[model samples]
Target: MTGTLKLPHEGTPGSSAEGLDARLVVERGAFRLDVTLTAAPGDVVALLGPNGAGKTTALRALAGLVPLTGGHLRLDGAELDRMSPESRPVGVVFQDYLLFPHLSALDNVAFGPRCHGVPKSQARAQAAVWLDRMGLTEHSSAKPRRLSGGQAQRVALARALATRPRLLLLDEPLAALDARTRLDVRAQLRHHLADFEAVALLVTHDPLDAMVLADHLVVVEDGRVVQEGTPSDIARHPRTDYIAHLVGLNLYRGEAEGHSVRLDAGPGITTTEDLTGPVFVAFPPGAVTLHRDRPTGSSARNVWRCEVAGLETHGDQIRADLAGELPLAADLTTVAAAELDLRPGAPVWATVKAAQTHAYPA
Candidate 1:
């Protein structure tokens, strides 16, 4: 990992969050995925990580789609490790919506209830109510092929909820929608989730989606959970470089003494935090100031000699990926970038104030 690295302390999560509890271990050939996930009733937990990080696999495990090779699977204190997929109280919304091509929107949702022994009329009536709540009553008779991506996603969600499962698993629920449609569907999804009283677990690589829909976050990498915390906590103090990049911050691992840190990268940096022993130092890219020459008479003790490795526009700012005595990313305005004639291999210096840096025990 190119970012600040920290390994997860090995141990089970002990107690599940509240409503759903799971410690999943799936062994396929030489690869293994071990993850502990928990969510209280009414809580939304997100499994966020890079591709092939086992987020979807964890979701599948919860829904009983994938059998756990080892570890416990529980819902509301009931052991479900050996339960069959159909017998488990789980609802799933797949990334692709997985709707039946020939079934109408109403029938698609009614299918779950009907399979559970509900009368045909009663199931269809319940499906109608769910469709109304999803604002899809007008399209109830439309087949899956006739629905737009957003509509299809809502129908899938409605179907999942129609089962009234105690645990809901959504795999990249909004991944298939267009940008314009995603915004609208995301709002509706959030609204629906707010009303849902059951435990909900979603898998996604998009940080925005996780932050928006989830109450807690579990960052998985290489089949291991590296970090777990609230969205705000993870965003403010990312433990790994991958997480730092996800949250748009520059992070470093170092040994701390008071407010000073001796970075592992062979440079010393100062921060305002009072700490000691091993620690993590983090600062937003916006906190970095670029200078053609080291600035004179500044209170910012954290200064480094660097050269621009790359530059690109990010939103309203120009982000410069720097490599030098201290490796980090810097955010500069378009105006500042042009003034410095910032380009690849340009000699530059970066400075950050001690107060701007955050140091915490690793």
Candidate 2:
């Protein structure tokens, strides 16, 4: 790299601001992404969603890799709408790290400051400090091919931070690491993010990653923000089916009056919540009990005649997708699944105690 990245139209330079405020809009053929994101210093927000949900598009738009069809981007207070990617005060850690194959770890981290006109010696000195902070001092002279996945990731992060960007964007930062490496890197990344003085945004497919590394979660669906909130709140009171499924809960929408809720699909279930009007009912799959035949004199408040639509192993338990008066998922042990002879199209009765269900206003 003789000169800095020559990317076109990253953003427009302007007066400084304190935090990030962005409304990103990008159109490609039939897909149009429109999302707004805002955050303060030291905030780590994770963009999470299914494939084709525009999470990556949002990140790219922020990085100036993808042009914004509309909307605006600001970091601290500086407008980033028309600045070139290299000119914007932003750092990006790609999924694969994208470290230079020909450069050593120290040189790779120094590359950013070097591009900004810093002398070679000064840049290398800064790179050394970053490598020390990342605990990669021994690997400073190692090439990218010789560095492990975790080490490469840390180097990429250090490179991004070396320039002291006001906004940091990370795309699937841990996806390349193995399970063991991911666990360790995730913890290290979390600590770094906690200490980061600037705003940080990351895109990840893994719910655990979003929950652990981000202080806030932004769930985008169909190029729009479906939900954004604290991880625990979204996990507890999911407002959409996508969110419910993401959190491993069976969710239903209904009209609630006192303790009873009339489901949209024409079934009524009793809940422990005292609410009125529209409400959403949610319960974990593990809370459901399945029986081959209808049970009599059961104390459970919710029971439905159902047929197994599918069965799959979920970790150590079997997850059964049931279709009936009220469609939902149930979790059972392999022994119980075998005892019930669970299979697609097999008739079964499912029950969930009201106490196990959570109800919230829609």
Candidate 3:
């Protein structure tokens, strides 16, 4: 099958600013991936998905590491579809932090400049500047073997940035770091990415990374883009179960008439949206209140009788998985749960206020 993609408007940085534009179609084995992406100068776009979602495949296509079976690739209005990897004005940071073990941190970063024909002195100077910006000046002489995971990641990012490419690509950037180091490095990475004056694309399965680091998000599933929007937009209105769980929201699709919506499972809910026809109703699990018995004088208009099938603790909140006429998930504080004596195999009434139920056209 063939498809057409309309390029989106992009902003320029300085008078000579450049951006990235790609419409790629790549096929391998039984799967074919197609994506059209455009990022303005200094825009950070995250490609989010689970395994086998083609996030990495799309990144590689843009970097010239994977040949596109069809479509076009352009950077700064220059055609790059036929260019080799070295000829493309792009930089990549792989997941493994592929630093040359024989070289020191400074030398590893300088390698890119050296390959581009810069003098050794100039390359090392530029490398030093990038390392210092990453707060790794003290580790300049340390080799990859001697550097910790976080240190190595910083060095990798510095190396990628040293080349001053018009487009940057990163794959699972923070996946290798420990929890403590991940937080620190993520913040530092965001700062440096912000300072960059070109387009940057990151591929990751981590929701927090995408939300915190990127201005826009593209969610890919099964080798296709399922959703694309701002981070807050995707979090607020997820289109699939995978994304609903990712953003910690309970989502339901139903037919709506005025303010009332009937679920496919045989229950009606009151919504605040003045929408009609098919619509989606969504609310966070925390919006649900569970009681052992039927509630009295409760202002909440939507209530359902549910049976607890499982329970689990998610950080400070308790997530109770319920199954009944309408299978749903609810989150509550440990204190509230204790007061309600909630447990597996217990029957309970679930209530949600109409104001809290968000409705949008499906």
Candidate 4:
């Protein structure tokens, strides 16, 4: 990729203070979405949630494709609440790339500039520069169907950047690629985002994508903002069960006294933290050990009688879902699982050491 290719609006006036500040609210049928977002220039924020959580709706509202019923949107001190999608200083890389089937890669990149009234020759010239930066100059003549998934993604991104947007929005940018291609494209996208000087918002369901590409995370649930923090902070201190599951931790809430926490779910567990009041206790699945029979005089402080609800292969480990006194998941080696003769409906004892658990304020 060429290092000298310059995007339009690189040094626009007042761009130093160009950032995103908005409270987005949209009402449709029986659903209402209310979310607040703020980001400084050069910040990449990821919006993550389960399906039907309004992630796509939020993106559409920002792009002016959906009208907001309440709240406001401001970018660089300009109100965009009434702006049309084509009039807003925003660029979006859609999930499917959405490249025109009949247009060549270069023509697709030039389309936005052409629509904005730039001369056809000048627009194509700018498109060539962008393709050069993306290291796709050789494929500029290929149609979208002829381009690979990764190549189509970059072309879409180049098209967005050519329009010189102050805010870039990506909707599931890597969701279309295969596993191996997703890995390579994710890294490439991260590098490109680092070079973007404007505020960027990314929507994705993958926790790893949010952690690797974004400086901050906003987790939406049921059309509302449930949590927002740095990826590390959110992963370490999940405030919701959905987040805990996303981060691969078995989480529970309970009333704490000293080092013991009596869970709201009916069981009690011992932790290493010394505190009182309501709290959350969590541990990794790998921290739990299962046995066919209760061990005698074990060092573990927490033990419960559980029955196997189900089992699944998780990478090289067996992830057993247990239901009983303290419902949770446990990861063990295949050999260990086989030795215990594990299966659905099988009775077993689960144990976790106090030091393996983490407790914090609820």
Each prediction's whole-model lDDT (CA): 0.88, 0.91, 0.88, 0.93
Best by TM-score: 4
Residues 1-362 of candidate 2: C-alpha lDDT, one tens digit per residue: 01222122223443245678999999999999999999977789999998999999999989989999898998766779789999988999999999999999999999999999999999999899888888889999999999999999999999999998888999999999999999999999998888786789999989999999999999999989988999999899998888899899999999999999999985998999999999999999999999988999889989999999999999999999999888999999999999999989999999999999999999
Q: Which tens-of-lDDT digit does each residue in 1-362 have in candidate 4?
A: 77743334444556544688899999999999999999987889999999999999999999999999999999877898878889998999999999999999999999999999999999999999889988899999999999999999999999999888889999999999999999999998898899887889999999999999999999999999999999998998888989999999999999999999999986898999998999999999999999899988899999999999999999999999999988899999999999999999999999999999999999
Candidate 1 clashing pairs, residues 3+ apart or interchain? 3-241
- The residue-level lDDT of candidate 3 at 234 comes to 97
Task: Write down the lDDT that model 1 would get.
Answer: 0.88
Predicted candidate 2, C-alpha RMSD: 5.0
The lDDT, on a scale of 0 to 1, for candidate 3 is 0.88
The sequence of per-residue lDDT tens digits that candidate 3 reaches over residues 224-299 is 8899999999998898888998998888989999999998766888998888898888998889999899999899
TM-score for all predictions? 0.93, 0.94, 0.93, 0.96
TM-score of 2: 0.94
Give the candidate number with the greatest lDDT. Answer: 4
TM-score-wise, the better of 1 and 4 is 4
